[model samples]
Target: MDERLETLAQRTGQWLRTHGWRLATAESCTGGWIAETVTAIAGSSDWFDCGWVTYSNAAKARQLDVPATLIDAQGAVSEAVVAAMVRGALARSDAQVALAVSGIAGPTGGSPGKPVGTVCFAWGGPGAAVRTQTCRFAGDREQVRRQSVIHALEGLLQADTTAKSVP
Candidate 1:
């Protein structure tokens, strides 16, 4: 793992612990990289709850309760699906906070609207409204995945600063 990612994970763990919260992750495209990065930190079990890698559309639908109709309408990488994914993560875990990521991080799989490196992210919990974003990063597969993980972590940190507490 990158040192910066490790640092971000460390910070995220601290934030979650401070609020007596735990985190769950729903991942796609980047596989389980987000989960892996956070769990790499020692004692992450204190703040990390669980993670699901729903790479295929079917898996997303079945595991995360992301509707098949929604995926057909908006695509798995769309903001809507990621929002659903985050909701599902929160529903399935005891964690008070959850994050979801779905993207086309590739040397291929680029469409006119959603090119490669196009990723959607969502964060939500019991009391917080789900926050969603679509980002277009420029990089190869590994780089795009790395950026996605960084952005996911940054979003958590941002919530810590901007809100009274993270969801």
Candidate 2:
């Protein structure tokens, strides 16, 4: 594991534990990398709830309840799909927080509009409004996935901070 990624995961686990919150993940391009990184931390089971590797559109729709029509209309890598994924993950799991990721991380999946390294992320919870983003990372497949994992972890931490300040 990359040292930076490991550090982010550790920070995320610490934050969730401090807030007595559990986290769930819904992954697409990053596969289960985000889940794997967080679970690598000791005692992560206290803060991590579950992870769904929805690599295929069918899996996203079936496991996370991401609407197939939404995926077909907006594409699987869109922010809308990731937002739905996070919502579905939280709905399906006993988690207080959740993050979702979808991307075109590849040397071959690039198109003119949605080129490779295009990743979308979402972070949400029961009371917090769902936040979504689309990022264009510059790297090969492995690097893009690595960046996505790191970004997802960071987003979780940021969302926690935002939720804390909402009062």
Q: Best candidate per TM-score, number?
A: 1
Global Cα lDDT for candidate 1: 0.90
Q: Please list the C-alpha lDDT of all candidates, in the order they appear.
A: 0.90, 0.89
Name the weakest run of 10 consecutive residues (lDDT summed) in model 1: 158-167
Local distance difference test, candidate 2: 0.89
**Which residue pairs clash within candidate 1?**
none
Error of 2 at 113 (Å): 1.1
The TM-scores, one per candidate, come to 0.94, 0.93
Residue runs of model 2 more than 4 Å from their true location after superposition: 159-167
lDDT of 1 by residue, 45-104 (tens): 999999999999999999989999999999999988998998889889999999999999
Across residues 1-167, which tens digit of lDDT does each residue of candidate 2 receive? 77998899899989998899999999999989999999999999999999999999999999999899999999999988999998899999999999999999999888999999999988887676788888999989999999899888888776434221211
Residue pairs whose backbone atoms clash in candidate 2: none
